[model samples]
Target: MTDGQFAPTVHDDIELARKMLIGGEWVGAISGKTFPVYDPADGRVIVEVPAGDAADVDRAVAAARAAFAPGGPWRSMTPQARGKLIWKLADLVEQNAERLSMLDSIDSGKPINEMRFFDVPFSVDVLRYYAGWPTKITGDTIPISYPAASGGRFHAYTLKEPVGVVGAIVPWNLPLLMAIKKLAPALATGCTVVIKPAKQTPISIALLAWRCEGSFTLNIAVIGSNITGLKRTRIRPPTA
Candidate 1:
């Protein structure tokens, strides 16, 4: 297929709902506003997605924070189990690669072959690669120069832990890969994620959120919105 051509047959198997994934549940924006997502292939109206505002962003952030809280499902899960779930997500993406490619092609106006051959497969590989990191994330022991109160040198060690909730903002070009790139490592490290996919390319992310809801036992929220919505959020990375 040439750069100017679009795939003649576009699959409609994915449920193109105008909803947001908040706390692993599909729901509409609180304001009940929806925005049109255009098919760049021909500038046609592909579907309508939720126009999430500040309230919705706050809800997604809260869900992520709760998931990352102490003793929460996400925080309580074993590292090995987390890795296995990421691996499973990678497998799911692989199983639906063709459909994802087609959807991305329509959403982003990219060539079908490029999405099929490069973007989709790379996302799978990235997820698989990050899946291995959960088990490998470790800290080190250190020797302290200061003497102990009792007279001997003190023993010091560091432990690796998830920082907190992550706010990932991905661009429209190569949407699938970019989202996975932000999500894979964060999930592997036991951090809950609030994803804000580009307004033009949220359909594939919605499909991914659906698959994750079915497969993952943890919390992950993918909200749809334009730039104005998420910018209002004050996400400060946890400082040591």
Candidate 2:
């Protein structure tokens, strides 16, 4: 194929989705059960993804916890370092945009041309935008006075910190872009995530895990549910 030639469209095989990524390792579902993913274009079973249960959720959470701990590299790294890593990921995404866009087109039944021209470029832009925020985050300094008259001067400052352990549950309609929109910012801000991608379109998310492997310490968990249990945890909602 020539450099400008568009690659032929290829759909994910069912067996590929059955493999679950947890704690940087690929493993089978807890119950060894699989769920069918249909091709909306024809309503045909295109693939069989793992039917994840509570055990899978637990494993993913544990892995994220390890990455979020005080001494963990993710937490200890400087914001600039984190930003650099994010930039590297953005570059990688650009490098693989064609393949990723093809996967998105197949899994979500969107037009391959649209995914190539619009969705993939938008995702890369979002990553690049968020990558610049790390260094700009700052703490506030406040003036304070002691109750006692003897006190001369006092100053107080509040530092912004990462809200650890984010559970992002995104819809299937636009799985790949949603994952990039949600996961990129959370990871950039020094938080660990357990993403429960919509069951109908799990392949793009699985592909995301594959691409993000070893770029940083991340624990991606796949669960077959619309609402994730992480909603009960201590995650702060994303600011507008």
Model 1, global lDDT:
0.80
lDDT string for model 2 (79-192, tens) is 898887778778877887877777767668898888778877888888888888888888998877767855687678998888887888788777777877987889778888
lDDT per model vs. reference: 0.80, 0.71
Off by over 4 Å in 1: 1-17, 147-151, 232-240
Regions of model 2 farther than 4 Å from truth? 1-15, 148-151, 214-240
1-240 in candidate 1: lDDT tens per residue? 133233444334334447788887789989888888887757777777778877787788888887788986778888899999999999999988988888888889899899889998999999999999998888888976764565677668899888788888999999999999999999998888988889898888887887667776557878866636456656543332
Worst 10 residues of 1 by lDDT: 1-10
Report the C-alpha displacement of residue 60, candidate 2, in angstroms.
Answer: 0.5
